[model samples]
Target: MKVVYLPGPKSPLEIREIQDPQPGADQILIAIHYAGLNHRDLWMKLGQYGGKKEDLVLGSDGSGIVKEVGSAVDKKWIGKKVFVHAAQDWGPDKNAQGKQFTILGNPRQGTFAEYLAIEAQYVYEIPAYLDLKNAAAIPLAGVTAFRALFTRARLKPGQKVLIRGVGAGTALFALQFAIAENCAVYVTSGQDHKIDQAIALGAKGGVNYKNENWSTTLQEMAGQFDVIVDSAAGSEFGKLIELCNPGGTIVNFGGTAGAITNITAQRIYWKQLNILGTTMGNNEDFQNMLGFLERKKLEPIIDKVFPMSHAEDAFKRMEKSEQFGKILLEIKS
Candidate 1:
């Protein structure tokens, strides 16, 4: 099997031929057809993420056909199309991930390879409405967005939603999910064209955060938002606080921009706002996300798909933040 291996922190990713893995007694061997890229992969490449950084396959999302099953697994799963849940050992807590939790890739083998032997419980049948390529885009970002909006923020239909940094995968998923729930969705992006793209995808409106008065412009255009989902936590985070409706909720899952600064305590207390932080979710969140995707038939927007041999180009695109949606790797087809 050919795998994309990160030799060490800040080192370039390389393709290496490695032995294929056989399923353990509780595992299923999947011949991965497609894999999705995330900022997590980019961060690992840049030595920014914690964990075993050297000698690892880097990918969190994937979809494929089950080629074989472990002795303890049901034979019925063989030949079924499925996607792998990106997180493992999320434990029993519904509100937070336990200490045993770890995302796919890094310390464990991941889906970037031609084959993946994952536990049977962590794999789900791909919905009949979606193909393997798009299913490859769903696991990580979709679950994170679902947990952030529905589980953490407790988003409601007909409410107003503001998704920050709209072009990224997770943010786009949040936008799509919120809109599906009948919420009026708005967005922010560094690029104006991405804002237009969001509008085309059913967002009510959007603004470019690069503008000096972007938040003010959004407030004037869309009024206050009931739920604000942000990944780029930075100096402008305070502006998000000001844009929230009283008693509204703000959920954050990443800090790509930098440390949050200039936020005032009084604004939050006065508004009785809920400020929550979340990460990759528990099993329940993943299951709910799958159900939502099946119910809504929501398709992920794929910006580009690179062949396994061109994995470096995929990482470069993510490094420059040039993508409008999920970037994928065509592993088998």
Candidate 2:
């Protein structure tokens, strides 16, 4: 088995041959077909997420076929193609929920290689319509958008949504999702080109946020949004707040821009706004996300993919945020 491990903060991720992981009592072994790279992978590589200093595998989203089952898992699951929920260990403890380490990647060993073993409950059948390549891209970004919008923001059809960043893959999904539900979407993108790209995807209009008065433009368009999904968390957070309508919701999943923002008491109290934080989702959320992808025939946003041997190159591209969507690594025999 081949795997990637970040030896230390800002150090080069070393790919090495490691022993195949054995399935635990409630676990299953998956012959990984593909793994999706995300900004979180870059964060962990830079040791920005408070992950332990040792070696940490670098992925969360992956799809593959079942190779073996643990004692408690059903044998019927063996040989089935599936995508992992990726948040198997997102609970309070390492009980039936699996270990606390972010499974399939993160603090735990990941699926960057030949094989991975994880809790059976975290694995779900990939829709027959979707192949392994698309399934590999679903778990992290799809589930995050689903959970953040539906679960966190409780977004409803006909509402106005301002998707705060067109740069991240999640924003692409969020815009399309809101449009599907009849919500009017206003997209703010750093790049002017992405603004038109977003409109083509489903947004009613797009704003070039490079301008200092970008927030004002959004305010002038729809006045305010019932929901705002913000990928940027730096100084723009205050601007994101202004985009929110009274009694509206703003969901914060990742801070692509940067963290640390000034908060004003007036913004919080006057608007009666909801500030929600979310991460990788629950099994129910993952299932719903899968259904959404199936119903809409939505394709996973893949910017680029590299061979297993070029895994480091893949990481560097993601670290630089050079891609508009998920990056992938292909594993070949």
Candidate 3:
């Protein structure tokens, strides 16, 4: 099996031949067809996430065909096309994740290889509407967005919603899901073209966050939002608080921009606002996300695809935040 390995922080990614992984008693071995990049991988490379230095296969999202099933698994799964959920050990609780929950592509070897072995329970059949390339891009981002909007924010149809950082994968998924629910969706982006793209995708409108007093301008234009799905938590978080309607919810999943500063406690209490935090998701969220995609016939946005041999370039694109959607690495069968 050919695999990409990370030697350490500040070191270049190198390809090498490694032994193929075998399935455990409750696992399945998959021949990977495509792997998707996430910001988590970039953080690990920059030594921000403290991932293992040696023998690390950096990827969390992938779609492939089952090559073999473990003894305890049904043989019928063999040759079935599927996408692997990145979270593991989610346990039975739907309200929250278990203590042992872990995402793929860190301490454990991941899908950035020719083959990967994962628990059979974590794999979902790819919907007929999605091809392998697009299916590979859904697991991490889709699940996160689903949980943030439906589970945390409890967004309802016809409500006004705003998704911060419109160009990233999770944010785009949130926009799509909110729109499908018949919500009036708005978005914010540092780039004006991204805001335009979101509007083209059925968003009611959008604003450029780079502009001064953009939040105030948006509030006047669109009124207060019922829900706000945010990834970047910085000075803008205070603005987000002001933009939400009374009793509205704001869900935060990622903080790429840095720590939040100058939040007003009085506003939260006076408005009866809900501020929630969520990570990837529980297994229930993953199943619901898949069902939503199938029901809506939704397709994930793919900005570009790179051959597995050029995986380094994919990482570079993600690091520079140059992509507007999922960046995929295609594995040649």
RMSD of each: 0.8, 2.8, 1.1
Question: How do all the candidates rank in terms of lDDT, highest first?
Answer: 1, 3, 2
Clashing residue pairs in all predictions, respectively, total: 0, 0, 0
Candidate 1 TM-score over all chains jointly: 0.99
**How does each model score on TM-score?**
0.99, 0.92, 0.98
Clash count in backbone of candidate 3: 0
- Of 1 and 3, the candidate ahead on TM-score is 1
Between which residue pairs do clashes occur in model 2? none
lDDT of each: 0.94, 0.80, 0.91
The sequence of per-residue lDDT tens digits that candidate 2 reaches over residues 95-176 is: 1233453545656777687788888888899998888887887788888888889888898989999888785667777777
| Candidate 3 lDDT tens digits, 92-119 | 7877788777889989998899999999
Question: Which residue segments of model 1 deviate by more than 4 Å?
Answer: none
Best by TM-score: 1
Q: Flag the better candidate by lDDT, 1 or 3.
A: 1
